[model samples]
Target chain A: MPDRSHTRPPRAADLGAFAPIALAALVLALVPLWAGDSRSMMTVVTTGLTFASYAVAFNLIFGATGQLFLCVGALAGIGGFGSVIISDRLGLPFLVTMPMAALLSGLFGAALSWVAVRRSLDTIFTGIVTLAFALSFQSFVLGRPELTGGENGLQVAGGADTLLRQPVEPYYVFLGLLVVFLVVYRVIQRSHVGWAFRALRDDDAAASLAGIDVARYRILAGWIGSMMLGLTGALFAHYRGFVGDTTYAFGSVDVRVLVMLAFGGIGTLLGPVLGAAVFTVMDELLVDQAQVRELIYGVITVILFLSFRQGAVPALTNAVRRLVGADQPPPREASSADTGIG
Target chain B: MVAVLIDGLVLGLQFGMLGVGLTLVYGLGGVVNLAHGQMAVVAAMVAARLMDRGTATALAVAAGILSVVALGVVIDRTLMQPVYRERSEHRVLLGLLLMLGVGFIIDGVLEWRYPIEALSLRITGGPVEVFGVAIRRGSIVASAVIGVVGLALILFFRYTTFGRATRSVIEDEEGARLCGINPGAVRTVIFGLSGGLAGIVAMTQAMTSPVVSTAGVGLTIFALIVAVVGGLGSTSGAFLAGIILGLVNTLSAFYIGTFVSSIILLLAAASTILLRPEGLLRRA
Candidate 1:
């Protein structure tokens, strides 16, 4: 890989672009406070934030990198199971087991990316492989009664109260982690590596010719994405106070994760978080009519995809640009120079 | 031991029937059609309904197949055709969402109409004793049918002009279009054929076991694994993979246990993607 580090100074404006992020954070923090009985509201907020992390991890590849991985839930499942096995079965502490689970999940993600990155497999093939992985993961978990506790699932020792010691604690923990991940995401998006990722997304051969290590970037994206998923899985397991193989099974919470990601918009940084929040509210409102909930969600997602192909975030950004009466920025010219490893 | 092998082979044939249909669609259309398994459920339910209305077994099967073909055509024309035209990255995602919605609609309608009560149908003959092993007559008929259909499909794809056109489009769309082939027409035919095959598989499997809405998703996932493990775009690959998977499933269930058997199969499928990403059978 060519070293392009000395070509230009790092983009300083991007680092200072945090006004919107701060506003968003403040809004989230005040949600429970305004809702009153802040406990339940905090619980809901924590859950949404945790899921948003998974979506963000997914967006690393799906959005910025342009690799669609349908097995996000399966990776999360791996993390959840790993944490449960280590913390509950092997008697390891939650903190220790959580990182271990995240590491293993990243390894699995890398393994998956290795199969997918080079082949130029179409979207359908990617879906097939990822879906198969998800199914296999579920089957393996459910089939192994000894290891996974079968359909009954493994029960962790502590509930949310035990870990957080109070509802507000979990809320703060999730919010802090969410902010940190967002920062990491934005930083990566503005970095040379991030540009390489975007380049590969647009055209792999061109990116490769430009000296970007496409395969390595894809693998790295998967690894990073899986690590985020693992973190969320661990947090979920701890919060729920139990882990079940069926938790990530098809048509269960896994589908909900996909819906949230899609609803918020693929490839956008803030879409997943917004999507999660929207879905949670919708789920709460439609709790009674659960049967038709997925149908409605699916329909809405289809409509959104049709109307806003680039996703809600981009669409909103474009609208803001138009409203401000600013000329649309010209597309960036492709750099002919070689860069460091993607 | 002989009985287990015989039973596994028969079950494997039934799975192959379903797997081949899925393989064909994926090969030609590049759509996974997550609703494929649910199509089987729809077929089985239709057959059961026909039987309840005092229809003959043959007639029930025919009705099931016909209904599935109609449903397939409708799906291809409306939901799938638009996605094909757009040719967007979201096609697969949208297809998945649409199918999930369809699955829900079908499940809801079926549950409301027929309920989940089990219906056991005996296809008239007693178990045949062959080489001191007893095999159900229904299993024998199902296996023979599957074998015949599989052979016919191979022959059609190999020799027929329509088959050549389909293969041409699958191999190189631009090249085929230059040669005056309509990819859309080929897609429609393939989808219809797949639906009919799914119907047959569903009918046979349901006859052997029982049909219910809850079983739809499980069977779809099972068929998907079989298709992927065998090879995504190869019919022969799917057939062979299904048999291999069936044997592994049976042997594992018998020796290790059902749970371990499932795990082993899952691990085997996953490891294949990691090791041989192209799958067991490579389509030339």
Candidate 2:
């Protein structure tokens, strides 16, 4: 079995990757000032930020853990419902509803992880299971029309007004959440738990033999990832001022989530954000040509996958590292603790 | 109650036919051929076109099945063959993308040819009163055909040398290769056969209900759900699960409304995974 315990400090190569993300964020932040259109700029920034957060959360399981979960959209949809229900039905404050929504989603993720871990299934089976979960949740929400607003969807009265009332407010709120999630993610990535996650992701049996408690780490990743997704979903619902069954529909937004994660570079902290930005911009530009957009999207995805298997971010980082006269950091050393276990 | 049960059986049989085709491709090739549903749609549309041209029902069905088999060969040779050698997780993902692309292309061609509304032909036949429940003769015919075909498939798999070769390849490709079995040839034949089966099922379904371009996407999703619930690689499991899902869907639609029925089906599939991750039937 391969070593599963070697840990490395954040290298100079890591800083090069972080530089691009920081620059992009700075540019996005200064966009309103340059464009002199506060409203549209705010919308773009907030939308991009929220989607980035969702993508990042999605990547935790998909990119980092190498688990192909198809329910990110539904999880976010659930989070949206959670926030909307708390705020609209129970009349809780947005601040209160947000954390509660995230918590519920995290718990939901944990439960899913528990099932996934216990089953000892392969990735494809896990994917199918999650896809089923997404469909089920969508159905449950739509069936209980009183809760999810069914097909017509539930409108949060004055919901958009509450946030859009102040353009800067929405932007700042999104920025704050994005920052918090990113910080938490970065810190987690540097921790032992994060290393455990990587180990399990690379090889579960080997990780288990290395005393990584594979299931526990997987569950933790799911919990954290889902919490972030839930939070983003709540913000999106509030921003859009509605929550509907269609919002969580699989094969629609679900495909988009996968596209975003892949486009941005799965597994990297900054990949999702970049992917989301590019996707949003492309979507906006292509919205006029509605008939051919899907075809184009499919073509691009296939080409990208065929050409750059590591995804765009990792591929680009590798190229940049090569250009900058930097030694490609040695592959992270796997812990050599377990030998002859079989 | 009797009506619901009969309806459930009819729908279940239909699902069983589709599920069987799906299991063949998945079990033999490890390729989730998302294109399975599209093949069914193509068959249905071809049959519809033949019927429009005043062809006999039997001839139309035969042509439809033949066309589907031809398309399956095309697919296997072009899109699927390139990726067959490397059976990685990424290949499965790529298969999904390829199917999605192919589905879109099919949809585009279909939209150009057929109108948006669903097209159907009512078989002029009297209803049969069974146990005090009046049911369409068409439903009875569909059930009988499905049962016969399903039984034939079971027999073929159990008794035929081709079936043994197919099973050997499915169990262990390398071992099969060592035993001098050509995996590629086996896969191509199975894919073509499965596509033919899908075509027949699609034609029968369109005859029973209506044919529409968008119906292809819905059928694909339904087939996928059915296949997953039945277990990806288990034929008997798919058959049983299809019947179960068909009953659940029909009864739920009757009692809970159409939209809710779909939701219920989705939820049931999800719950099944939660309960039995390997599926109800574990194929050896």
Candidate 3:
């Protein structure tokens, strides 16, 4: 890692960058106050938090950098299944297995990024390759019924004695994880890593010309982002006390995260959190219309991609900014503004 | 071994056919239609519904293919218009995401309305002997259909002026425009052609096995693998890669296990990316 301290954002801007994350964390911390009594509501909120973390991680890899990994579910599944298998088969503790699982997932992600970078695959080719990996991972899981329990899923018996299974406890745990993810994201944004990310994302050749190691930064993003996914996945498995096909299936996890990240602003700090919250509420409201739920989601995805390619958050911010009579655009944070292909 | 090889060849032809639609779209527009398989399923469902209503099979199939062609045109006109406005990487990303959403919509609609509907065409005939091996009549007929279509595509692209114009657009859109070619019109025609091809593949697939409503994603994956391996835009390359992957698929399934074949195929595609990003056949 090259010393990039000189490239760090100004202290005021760094602090300003974290303002939204802090606000989001503060608001989300209050979710359990009213919903604590209802087990179902707690589960719903916790699930939302998990998705928010996944979206944040995705934002780092895709929104920050330009690596469009289509295997979000698979990376998370590695964490979920890795921890479960380690704890169950090896009799390891949850604490030991969780980090181990995350590290393993991170390494897998790094390998993937290395391949993409070495091949110089563009966004769509990277997506295709990662999607292939994701599908293969699903097949591997499904094929190895003796190991994975296949469609029946596996029970996390190791965490059965812990408070993780408690309705409200898991919500707080996931909320804390989300906070960690947000803080990590903001810190990265203020550091030289963030500079490299933006530079490479805009134009890798230019970034390389400017002495930024594009491959190193890209692989670093992949590793860190995948670690977040793996950690959250492991935590969720333990919290829910089960891991199944649906838990990390591409449709259930990856698609939802993509929609969420896109719905929020792709590269915005609070986009994932806002998107996850809105979609979670929408999910709850459409619970009665199960058949049409996915259809509605599909329609919304299409409409959202077509109409607000940048997302609702940035659009809303722009509207508010114009209303307040600001002539110049807001200070460029980690944003998708003018994300034209170089 | 010969029997397995023959079976693989049959499967490979279908895979090649599937790849053609996806590869053509990508070559022409730099858009990988994630809904390619969904379009096929939609066509299958249409044909199935018509057949269920006592319509003749030939007429039902024609309607099914035609409906998808119309869908492709509509999508090119409406959904893809915005995608086309974006350039380079953004265009690819937007197109992919939008098509993915379309795929989900198609899947949701098909699953909701026709949960149990499936298309399985039964071509009744005795097993045909080839190289001292008996092959199913359905497989033989399906292979024949694919072969004919493949030949037709080759001829059309090689000799037709429209085909040359289409290739020119894929090669250099701006240059093609300078030469008086309407890239949008060409894309529309190819998209419709791709849709028709997808419908035909679905029909052929049904002759051997049922094409269920839920088969969209799997089919999409297969098409993608074939397209990527064959080289995104090369028609002949698709057939070549398809046969290779199809053999690998069948052989692995036979020798290793049924579950390992897909993984192997995917690994093959991933390695192809590593070794040859342009695919197996470089466009001449």
Highest lDDT: which candidate?
Answer: 3
Note the chain A TM-score of all models in turn: 0.83, 0.83, 0.89
Writing each residue's lDDT as its tens digit, candidate 3 over A178-272 gives 98898998789767898889888878999999999999999999999999999999988888889987789888898899887876667767668
TM accuracy, model 3: 0.93
Q: State residue A182's C-alpha deviation in candidate 2, in Å.
A: 3.2
True contacts kept of each: 0.31, 0.36, 0.58
- The DockQ-based order of candidates, best leading, equals 3, 2, 1
DockQ of 2: 0.39
Give lDDT tens digits, candidate 3, residues B34-110: 99999999999999999999999989989999999999999999999988888787788778889989998998898
**Candidates 2 and 3 compared by lDDT, better number:** 3
lDDT of 2 by residue, B1-284 (tens): 78888888887877877877877787776777776777888887887788878998788878888998989888777777645754566567656656666776666566656746453646678988988889887778777778888888888887898888888887888899999999888888888888887887776665578867667777777778778888777777888988999999999999878767877787788778767766679743
lDDT (C-alpha) at residue B241 in model 2: 87
Q: How do the residues A1-342 of candidate 2 rate in per-residue lDDT, one tens digit apiece? A: 012222444555655424433554555566557433666756766776777788778878777676777888888887888888889888778778888988999998888787888877677767877877787787788678877787889887536557544766777677667767766766677678778877787778899999988888888888889998898888888887777777667765667777666654556666566567666766667778776676567665555444444333434344333332332111110001111011
lDDT string for model 1 (A85-163, tens) is 8887777778888889999999998887877876656555566667767777877888777898888988776343364
lDDT of 1 by residue, B182-260 (tens): 8888888888889999888877776566767556677777788888877777788889888888888888888888767
For model 3 chain A, give the 10-residue run with minimal summed lDDT: A333-342
List the candidates' TM-scores in order.
Answer: 0.86, 0.87, 0.93
